[model samples]
Target: MTEYVALLRGVNVGGVTVRSADLKALFAESGFADARTYLASGNVRFSADGEGRALKTDLERALAERFGYDAWIVLVTLAEMRAALDAFPFDASDEARQPYVVFCADPAVREELLASAEPSDEDPIAPGPGVVYWTPPKGSSVDTAFAKQLAKPRWKAVTTTRNLRTVAKICA
Candidate 1:
């Protein structure tokens, strides 16, 4: 069985919720083994033998049926996760700043996205497959022009923002 991380979008945010234990049970019911949730924002780690794409679709369908809401699931294998972590452009030691990994479902060219924005301190960098890294500028800075632009496309993607501590904890 391959270990995979399932990033779920638009679930359990704000006041809307799904209990982690229940979510784990749901995954177990769907034939996943060793299902565990990391953090409260719908990141699940599990092992399964199916193709990632197929598993994504299945999990989406299962969540919708079980919870009465549509869920966008992005599946990443352990190897892919490691690659994403390795590809982070900024040094993880910089805890004073935020680090984000935006996972694009389609292999969209980084140049295309970067060209859409003017380079600034907050500019995002894509170092390798399926990942974009960004560090936001200071206080109440609504300078996430890249994120705003990306959101407009309705692309099959999800952004997970984590500090170096969380990343280390997850990988460890």
Candidate 2:
């Protein structure tokens, strides 16, 4: 069985809140083994024997039936998640900006989304398989154009972002 991390998007934000225990129970009842939740960001880790897409569909349907809401569950295997973390584009010592990974829900749209983005000198973005590594200028003094561009509907609907620190914790 592969250990997969299912990252739930748009939860615990804008009035939507779900308890971590309940989320883990939901996963367990849905037939996942060793179901666990990390943080309050709706990140669930579990072991299962199936494809990522199929698991995602199952979890989404189960969530809709139990919670009365449909959420996009982006699934990534342990190896894949670690690979994504290891592929960070920026150097570790670079303090000028903070690194983040925008995980694409669909590989088919990865290129399309990257192509549509226009990164400025303030933020240098790198596109990887199923992930985009980017860094916005650090501190509150710098303009957040790149971050704003990411918040736009085009990318927001299809991608979920986690900072380098979060990614490290997840992979650790």
Off by over 4 Å in 1: 109-119, 138-142, 156-164
- Per-model TM against the reference: 0.83, 0.89
Per-residue alpha-carbon lDDT of candidate 1 for residues 1-172, written as tens digits (9 for 90 to 100): 9998887776787454777887899999999998988877787888999888789889989988887775777678867777777777876566455666665554554445555555466554554566566665434224467656656535434444444344445565
How displaced is residue 106 in candidate 2, in Å?
2.3
lDDT of 2 by residue, 71-108 (tens): 77778887888898988878745788777888888877
Each model's Cα RMSD: 2.6, 2.2
Residue 2, candidate 2: alpha-carbon lDDT = 96
